[model samples]
Target: MNKLIFLLFFAVTSCTTFSRYSPHNKMESCVEGYYCIVNDSLHLKYETLGGFYFANNLKEYRKIKVKNKPKFKNIIFYGKSNILDTDYYLILNNEIYPKNFYFKETVINNKKITIALNSNTNGTYNKDFILNFRLPK
Candidate 1:
């Protein structure tokens, strides 16, 4: 009985299996700025190169993990990219999200854009956040 209880305790204590998301500014061998993303806090360093473009498995909230329960996911995405250039473009449609959260290039255009998210991560939501600005005409 003691051995069984020990095993159960180990399993419960090791249940930090939640997803993570973090974005940083980086350049892809070019002078232009690009978003460097990291997913899964438990991922090995070898698997973090080039970063990810779309990460929709982030755990926005904290919760206890129970046996056989659904996994926690996190979400963090980089800016848009152009085929001809490595620089990423992002129209800050949501001022709530920090403009310096990651690398993003602003264009002189006026069209509004949005990125829709469809995920099953618990407590994780893709809300409508808009950030609109324009350059000198």
Candidate 2:
């Protein structure tokens, strides 16, 4: 009887915990070197980085190299010449995204770097949205 009660309790607890985690609703966003997740939805909206530079000019853009991970849906580059006013171009699955932004002239020793972007999603221009990027080795 004791064993039966314990099993019943365990089953109920396990089901409840498992139901909270959903693989189908995850949301992922990758900027620079950082990847952000919302839930389980895979479609991530990307934004361009304005005024981002390496040395004297903007850092050139590059292809995303993700290993042991799912393929990205889109990539874009917003040139610094426009700076805070330029919009990013969408790079679709079949198309290649160009690396036109300038990187700091200094040698990048890290494998990844995170960058934050201004958030206008709320229509009030809140400064909370951050875009993270992963730099290549």
Candidate 3:
């Protein structure tokens, strides 16, 4: 009985007391200031190379393991790419989601853009949050 109780306690604490995002960034060869997560609080690190894009459309790819339940305001994404003023799609779980899917606001300046993530308004906490952007030509 004591052993079972200890195991249950360990499971519950492990899940609740820690973040779901990974602490390690996996994209080792990303072009500097191009495809990466900028915020420090989100604690998201790519577990895989995520995905690749065609030469025509340079997609930013990231497959981060969900280590913690993210705070709505803390989820910020800063990106720099060629398609600045064009529409962008956030591809999650092999589906196309809007840029504002989990965004509270987005500010674009030149080739840089900052996206502030919102609460669970449009997306949910899953095993992994895939960052695959579909930018227009």
- Every candidate's CA RMSD: 15.7, 17.6, 15.0
lDDT of each: 0.27, 0.28, 0.28
Clashes of each: 13, 28, 8
Clashing pairs in 3: 19-67, 19-68, 20-66, 20-67, 20-68, 21-66, 21-67, 21-68
* Model 3 TM-score (2 dp): 0.25
Q: Tell how far residue 127 is off in model 1, in angstroms.
A: 2.8
Order the numbered candidates by lDDT, best leading. 3, 2, 1
Error of 1 at 17 (Å): 3.8
Higher-lDDT candidate among 1 and 2?
2
**Order of models, best TM-score first:** 3, 1, 2
Query: For candidate 3, what is the lDDT?
Result: 0.28
Query: What stretches of model 3 exceed 4 Å from their correct place?
Result: 14-25, 29-32, 36-116, 119-137
lDDT of 2 by residue, 80-107 (tens): 2233432222222213222532121111
Kindly report which residue stretches of model 2 are placed more than 4 angstroms away from their true locations once superposed: 18-21, 25-29, 38-137
Q: TM-scores, in order shown?
A: 0.23, 0.21, 0.25
Model 3 scores worst on lDDT over the 10 consecutive residues at 54-63
